[model samples]
Target chain A: MSLYIKYPKYLTAGESCVVVEFADEIDRGANDAVMNLKKYLLTQKDISIVECLPTYRSLAVYFDPTVVSADEVINAAKSAPELDGEECASSFTEISIPVCYGGEYGPDIANVAEHAGISEEDVIKRHSSKSCHCYMIGFMPGFAYLGGMDESIATPRLTNPRTVINGGSVGIAGKQTGIYPIDSPGGWQLIGRTPLRLFTPEASRPTLIEAGYEVRFVPVAEEEYKKIEAEVAAGTYKPLITEAK
Target chain B: MELIIRKAGMLTSVQDLGRWGYQSSGVPVAGAMDLPALRIGNVMLGNPEGAAALEVTLLGPEIEVKGTGAAVFAGADLGFSVNGKAVGSWRSVVLKDGDVITFKGPRGKGCRGNLCFAGGVYIPPVMNSCSTYIRAKIGGVEGRALKIGDVIKIGEPAALWKKLEGFCLPEDLDPAQDANAPLAIITGLQEDAFTEEGKKLLFESEYTITAESDRMGCRLEGAKIEHTEKGADIVSDAIPLGAVQIPGHGMPIIMLADRQTTGGYTKIGVLTPLSMEALVQKMPGSKVRFRRADVSEGVAEQMRIKEAVRRAKELRLSHVSRTHSEAPKPLFGHFILTVEGKRYEITCEEI
Candidate 1:
């Protein structure tokens, strides 16, 4: 049976901001509360909120300091609807991203495979078979924190961080798996690569995957990876997005 | 109009009144560190407050004019000269093509120059402002610093430029010498999070600006204020300009124009808007003292200062229209400078 835990009472973040916390302690339930609260707050259009940033277990709502007071934010937040259980269970969209496992694209894949006590092929198959939920966006814009990776492929982060991880590089750190949005420094263990551009400033919605979206991986050959990367760079690669069924 | 950089001073960048309305997207509100001086310099050349100007650091720059121009130097009275002849500050001077403008030396605290043109600098607005933010790579030269050989375009002179005279001035064109004036601060939302002793330390004790001060925030070194609830960890929250935030290490960092939109530190107080201009002008190594003030006091102070500035503008408008009816045309070009040990150049044009 699942247990329901409410967060601490909401408090004024600033003169115009309010933080409605679900829990101070970090846990799966706390994370769920934050996600639910964020989804619920997104539906409340009259709140005059400028931005809503959700973290591991809390959400910060930024409003115009001149327009709304802290007291008003508190009242509005309290009046917001409670989260429904069914929506939480089935709101994510599963997406299959093609990845090229091992070799230069994933230098640490052998290490991860050895640590997981499994063959490299088994590791690739297992990683490609699971559907993961997008938990949050952070570190840089458009980078999503995906939950629900296959336990067989779980690995800790590298002792040293890579100076540059190219965009679309698929990496796993501990239990969290994600893709690099831009060329940035990271400590995640790279197990594969993708041709998808997770973030592009020129795109209408820069972030292709939003929080709560589901993700799946499909293995591709190294040469195929190269072709896809070239096509994406040339602006001709069409992403395989499945239509709503 | 055009100007060539003779010498690029240390940390010189193109600025305006500061970029606003996009702070939510994490873009900084970058502009002049000393805003009053920048505004006056623009106003003197008949440019609006938001006109692009040059933010010159302690070290001045050097440049040569390419066309007729008129510009005024304001703030900190940095020693300035044109073609070996010392120039008077807070006044408009016309420059002919081929004339060299240079900063001779640093004269006082927080030196800046607003070389306004008749039509203002015409740099394309990136994210709605010409202000440069070096980090996060947004605004100004593809979100980068001005390097050597960058050619900046000057705006066309205003249509009503002929009606303006020389640079505007206050009836009392004198500096207020009260270096020890108490900074009025309104207790912030996290005021109660600080100990009473911390409040006393903030208001009573003195602090000096560290060399780490920049457009981001002012790092102060002095008495360490105590936080209440000893080990309480607070989540990050939205921070505004003039906020005095105390991080885990206990020193107070006053947020400035380019500060982050959100911070995890505890903000004990926020400076009154009336004091922000004055505070910005305080040079490095300058001592600052804070004084507790209620919200009403802050509001009243803001009202008084706004009224004073409004009256000053009106008087200057009348004086300019009556005296010199023609725009003080300058020979367009850039001004060069050398401050302390750094070297840089800034563009100058006639408004």
Candidate 2:
């Protein structure tokens, strides 16, 4: 692992926000930089930062222009503690998501396997092999942008996207993989379905997984998936959040 | 104070400033599109600028007042009437328990109107706001539009400045009114992604707001801005207020209050706050142009509006003091005054 030493660009977004762009391309280190800046920025009380949006490669710091100046916010963002490769790998609540792949759950699993020149079983194995880092949660509520997809299973998105993809559907787009927290029209190649509710609007914490967390998929049988779904609907299903050792 | 919905119009929902501070999890700032109008409506009634109000679309709601209170109809005049008698817009008026508020006749200059009460609309704040994000099913009146027979509870006005009826905001100060000048834009966010001709067309050509335009975004039909080989897609990033995103189709879509947290399109520019106010008022099929502007212009306009709202509140307070013959309430504040990097704590107390 190498230390993140690249300087960031401060792009002004209208009069209300300033985007601290760490990288133009999606870089893991840049995403970490964004998360670190956001984590540090929230602790400061001097700047009247109304809100913050941490993306894959940038962090948009929102504030009321009537109260704080862009220059001041830029200064505050600049002062965020820089991290080395080791410190950047800070402790994260590793969220283990149980997924049921193939058949009705993942309609495009076969398509993805054919496109990648691999078997459907190999596709699932590769997808669940590594722990994908959650870069940012966006699009729909609780939709997580999970990076670190295995290049062997990398596939392009479906040309004709479905009108409505079910919530908790895991999919892949180009080199990136993500979860559709809610039902939405999407182009990503469907691979699996998770029973856990990513977005519980009525719950105290609206979103289950957040940015800067890690998500690992554990393949479950159809019966187990059905059992978990019932438990979730009953409000008795607790997501397995284990410490990453 | 309480209100009952006699007839819920096309689209009427409770809205405050916005659901602020939460965007990372994909929550949008769903509030009144005509924010200035909403703010002024609240201000005229001696309510805080961000107090919850009923944002009515072209066709306004018919409400049966069940409790006596003060209310003001601001923004696009939706032909507000009480007991079938027409009333003026932008003025604070007393609402009796029996008063029936209705929207009759043709629509006004703007698309939306804000019906504000002296005391804010008393709805539980979801994520610290009453603004309704219908798509997310969060915030305001059960996170949905007010339907027939829905009860609306009103909160008590701030003790410092209670509702003072008869305070009318001058037409000149109304933010719902459009400016003669073109919309101002802080240009060139992803300037490289667009050709020079594309950039010029953005400032020169007239854009017609399409029918698809709503709170989430205003889709525009205009000159096709040429995209570079890089195409329109970029790593998804935060969608700023008034972000002019030119997609692969070469047309521009201006992101608004209910836009998603982040987007992948190339944003060529961000519209100034004043431009946003003016743009929201323009009905579908109306034309709009953009002019180059800097941050200072926006800041100046914001300060101007803030000062006006502050003065209006003070003026109404003065009138209340004169009528009641009461001493002003106690006020206290603590401020950190920084001069040339040197910090100083400043405190002021009204004794």
Compare the candidates by TM-score and give the number of the best one.
2
Tens-digit lDDT string for candidate 1 (B83-167): 8776745666666778887887677744555555556667887656788877555565565555556655667754334444344
Distance (Å) between predicted and true CA of A91, model 1?
Answer: 5.2
Each model's lDDT comes to 0.68, 0.84
What residue pairs are clashing in model 2?
Answer: none
A1-245 per-residue lDDT for model 2 (tens digits): 33334448888888889999888788888898898899899999989999989999999999989999989999999888786668667666798999999889999999889988999999999999899999998887888888888988888989998999999999989988888888889899999999999987667788889898888999999999999999999999999887753
What does the i-RMS of model 2 come to? Answer: 1.2
For model 2, the superposed segments whose C-alpha errors exceed 4 Å read A1-7, A117-119, A155-160, A234-236, A243-245, B105-108, B158-163, B324-351
**What are the TM-scores, per candidate, against the unseen true structure?**
0.72, 0.89
Distance from true position, residue A217, model 2, in Å?
0.4
TM-score of chain A of each: 0.87, 0.91
